[model samples]
Target: MGITYRRILLKLSGEALMGDLSYGIDPAVVNGIAEEVSEIAATGVQIAIVVGGGNIFRGVKGAAAGMDRATADYIGMIATVMNAMTLQDALEHLGVPTRVQTAIAMQEVAEPYIRRRAIRHLEKGRVVIFGAGSGNPFFTTDTTAALRAAEISADVLFKATKVDGVYDADPAHNPNARRFQSLTYSHVLTHDLKVMDSTAIALCKDNNIPIVVFDLSVTGNVRRAVMGESIGTIVGGLCEVC
Candidate 1:
């Protein structure tokens, strides 16, 4: 059978691009992700990616250190542009037609974010990468991903993370942390699961978009998630308990 979702938005955390490094992008990791994306695209799935900037810089952390919140968030936004460019290069190297659309204007390096143009690119089988985190301060990339998924009318939002799925506790700190197979958006917001920011979750809940939180570190997990193979915790668009 074919894949379940025809179109998807993949939310990649910036920290996942770090690989084994303490900071900055790792070429190998970026290339691996590109490879996976390429494979899925070849199977006729339209993919759009929204990358975070937490590995290079975090707005909240900067704000905690007394930097002006707006300036710090702008810096974080630029970091995501850097990541978008890197991923674009990697995808192009694999012969996958890709485009980088930045929320913040950077005419030379990438196109400005235009919803209809992005949808056109996806229809043409070109992967679109969204950068710059909504072109607004005090907004997380998680929210950007949610907003883009809604705009693009993606069937699912694939949240690629380090953990296999959402847990009752931080899995690294709690060995016995229970991995949830599925959850409702209310459950996430109520428990403060940290799977995503509450605003992002609420957006998905309201838009009726499903989210699959899976481990990107696992070699084939991205493909699995896109194929609806039940490799991770799913949230939203469900009324039954799991």
Candidate 2:
């Protein structure tokens, strides 16, 4: 099959890293994702990743409990760094060259986010993982994925989530919920699909970047997505007629 995308940005939620566990990272899940990413890297796709921190911390949840929003968000950013390192280690073990860059300055642990440097790493065939959620309290990793995709000029943004695709209702609760195969940017926002935050959606819309939302639990799906298999809902510009 022909590849649909050459350079892509992958958005992985920290909850996906936890797998069936209640919290924290699961080795098996991490290894599984690493193996898949390694396979894609070997296929010569320039990959950039933005990982979430919900497994360890959630700023919004903390704020709901009376904590200062910005402070809680900073902690959430740190949590993402931890997840990023874990992913980096996993990918490295699979013999893929990886680099972890953070929006926040963490020189001792990983390199700081630099646009040119990140693109350079991708050019050298190294998988670059971006963590720390845009170094802003209110911004989400979803938005970060959009921002980075725009910065690096990625061909597409792949959002690997627990669900298969965007549905009319919460598929977990509403068994009859319908999944959309493709949608326009306005449609995603007009209906509040919640596939990602509105800001992230708007960012992609402005940049004309396509977003592919698919289930991460399905093994080999990453390769399938990269190869343009019709496995998930496409948003922004991939739709022919939504």
Candidate 3:
């Protein structure tokens, strides 16, 4: 089956991997995500993933606790590398070709990130997982996703989250909060929406890349989003349709 998007960058939070656990990855949840990704790849969509490390360790949180900010961030980047390896193993177990590339050179475990190689992997129908953020401190994984999406020339950025879509307010707290089917990049930035970090949002905006915020917990939502179904909030030029 052909997908609406030929290529996409998927950004998943470390918290999403946590599932019901307080910290660390939940195998079942990770496996479910891997299966979903495999299904999407089978449909011929090139997928590149960037997994965050907030579940295992948050750099900002660590820095707040008096740790050297750069050191804390570096540790956080390593945490993401761990998540990437686990995800790569799961994807391979499902018989899907996957590669883990890290910004920091940990040649013993994963390949050092190279833009051309990553694009080649996607072109060859392999899932490429980008780890270790931008190899720089003070950069969030969201920014890494946006930067990679722009570099890889992805058609869209899929932000897999617990919530179905972007809302005017915290949907969990305000029962009456309104959910937006679509939103403009300016609107997101102007309102300072937490949909993504400012740097990430600005990067996507500058590159003219659309973003889809969808609930990854839903079994078929990934496929739905890839096929351009109206399942979640869309940010960018396409919001005019909403």
Instruction: Report clashes for each candidate as comma-separated counts.
Output: 0, 0, 0
Q: In candidate 2, how many clashes are counted? A: 0
Residue ranges of candidate 3 with Cα displaced over 4 Å:
238-242
TM-score of 2: 0.98
Pairs of residues at least 3 apart in sequence or in different chains that clash in candidate 1: none
Per-model TM-score on C-alpha atoms:
0.97, 0.98, 0.97
RMSD per candidate (Å) reads: 1.2, 1.2, 1.5
Worst 10 residues of 3 by lDDT: 233-242
Q: Tell me the tens digit of each residue's lDDT in model 1 across 1-242.
A: 45899999999999999999999999999999999999999999999999999889999999999999999999999999999999999999999999999988999999999999999999999999999999999989999999999999999999999889888888899899888888999988987889889999999999999999999999988888877798879997463443
Model 3: pairs clashing at backbone N, Cα or C within 3 Å: none
Q: Each model's C-alpha lDDT?
A: 0.93, 0.95, 0.94
Weakest 10 consecutive residues of candidate 1 by summed lDDT: 233-242
C-alpha-based local distance difference test score of model 1: 0.93
C-alpha RMSD between model 3 and the true structure: 1.5
lDDT of 2 at 58: 96
Q: How accurate locally is residue 191 in candidate 1, as Cα lDDT from 0 to 100?
A: 79
